[model samples]
Target: MFDHVVFGVSDYAASKAFFLKALEPLGVMLVSEGPLGIELCRPDSQSSLCIRRVEAKATHLHLAFTAESRGQVEAFYRAALEAGGEDNGAPGLRPQYHANYYAAFVIGPDGHNIEAVCHQAEG
Candidate 1:
């Protein structure tokens, strides 16, 4: 449970564009922008992810966003790939984590492991 997470991207424009498009299904929107960078989050959520321009290599990290349903996870996976993200894992169950854990993973523009997951059983 973080209020926000900040990270650097080698290509600011590319990484920013990738996240904005890829996270559309999750309702993430640009919240603010400043000299520091840009902040993005869903309108109703206080948490956000901020991307800043940097020349050094980005430190890779896994970031996961909760999905309201399995459909959102599927949508996010497709959108992320179309937005130039590399597929780390396709949308599917990861019963090892939990009986109803369904998720999709993608390597983002900055090599961050981005994921969307739903913990509910399929209807």
Candidate 2:
């Protein structure tokens, strides 16, 4: 629903690195970077996420990525935690949301609730 989302991160380098590792399984790649910030997006998508280096108080944001499959969700969770993200939720079915709402959540360096979810039923 968003063309792109922009936010400021206090630790630009760390945040950028964390996201690069965490979202790799989701096919998100660095689209561009400059002295001030960087942008990332999936190879097959047009939506982008931008993070800027700024002097501001710590803020929290929830960003969810669409995973193509439950395996991708699992891979994303493992990669995210390996990248230094704190586990907010493990990969599993969230029947509360739907029958096949497999997803995972991680706390990013900037304390954002990052999630990857797949809506398709198991094959």
Best by TM-score: 1
Candidate 1 C-alpha lDDT tens digits along 28-67: 9898989878999999998988999889989988989999
TM for every model, in the order presented, reads: 0.96, 0.96
Candidate 2: global Cα-lDDT? 0.92
lDDT of 2 by residue, 86-109 (tens): 999999999999888999999998
lDDT of each: 0.93, 0.92
Q: Following a full C-alpha superposition, what root-mean-square deviation does model 2 have from the true structure?
A: 0.9
Index of the highest-lDDT prediction: 1
- What's model 2's lDDT at 50? 91
Model 1: worst 10 consecutive residues (lDDT sum): 1-10
Model 2 poorest ten-residue lDDT run: 54-63
